[model samples]
Target: MNGKRGMHYVGWKTLCKTKASGGLNFHSAVSRSGPLKARLSWRFLQNKDSLLYQVISAKYGNNLWDATNRRGSSIVSKILLEGAQ
Candidate 1:
């Protein structure tokens, strides 16, 4: 568990032990794997999509952050839209 935005509090997969870990690796881990500090740092931008993300289609861009994080994934996932709400 890490303490990035409260990752230690939220949850993380176990890793590097007698048991296999589900720890996030930069190459494959989801953008949500950002540390709490990163999350908090980038959080202010959540509601408004950044020009770059909007232009390039960043997956963690503002709209996704707001719709996904603001309402929680279950609601977002259930929405079933090609674009996030």
Candidate 2:
């Protein structure tokens, strides 16, 4: 036999689902980054006194809680703020 595989039996969306949903636990980049962005947002909200928060605040010149519509905020700051919302 040539051992050539035929058409896929399962769709890509089904294959990419979590194992708990009856598929292999594979994470797409967008799916994986969501939780990471949420964690960063949570950290930024909870740890205002931390050095990382202080550094980001110093550079961005906006409080994490009230960072909306800032002029010079970094892209990372904006993304985290959006995720927080």
Candidate 3:
């Protein structure tokens, strides 16, 4: 033997299924992030004293919720803005 072990790579769809369905029960990036981003946006709205909220407010202005002017926001900020809506 050349010391090579036989193994098969799992497909993404298989990996993303529930363990009961014979998969690893993993979540894809988009599946995991949408709700999490929305949750973060909600936290920003509800918790003004948090450091994240303070920083976002300062950088994006106090009216970060304004949808009309997202001219130069970062990807994260854009995600937060979309999640808020």
Candidate 4:
């Protein structure tokens, strides 16, 4: 809809902003996914005794905070660490 012929009345960034900020209140994919990823990371951090967490910890070790060496870390672990940060 950024095309000239289309109804490109507002910019994408503006359209993605919240109505409280004087925009349409639509959420961009990045903004929406960010919170969900963060929530997943938080859950992983808080639910250490959970089965899923235990499995992950067993595979990757329980050192979630020290990700300096990500050589053998799983993709999910990396994503959770980055999202938490």
Best by the TM-score measure: 3
Among all candidates shown, the one with the greatest lDDT: 3
* Candidate that beats the other on TM-score, 2 or 3, i.e. the better one: 3
- Rank ordering of all candidates by TM-score, starting from the highest: 3, 4, 2, 1
| lDDT (Cα, 0-100) at 85 in candidate 2 | 68
- For all predictions, the C-alpha RMSD in Å is 15.0, 4.4, 2.7, 4.8
Model 1 sits at a Cα RMSD from the real structure of 15.0
Clashing pairs in 4: none
Q: Which stretches of candidate 2 lie over 4 Å from their true place?
A: 1-24, 63-72
Where model 4 places Cα greater than 4 Å from the true spot, the runs are 1-26
* C-alpha lDDT values of all predictions: 0.38, 0.76, 0.80, 0.79
Query: Per-residue lDDT of 1-85 in model 1, one digit per residue for the tens?
Result: 4545653442343332223344543232553434533553344236346553353235434444344344444432223222322
Query: What tens digits encode model 4's per-residue C-alpha lDDT throughout 4-83?
Result: 57555788889877888878977688767777879988898899788868877887686766765868777787778777
Clashing pairs in 3: none
lDDT of 2 by residue, 1-85 (tens): 4659666588767878898898887667777777788888888779889887888878766555566666776778777876776
Task: Give the winner by lDDT: 2 or 3.
Answer: 3
Locate the minimum summed-lDDT window of 10 residues in model 3.
62-71
Query: Is 2 or 4 the stronger prediction by lDDT?
Result: 4
Whole-model lDDT, model 4: 0.79
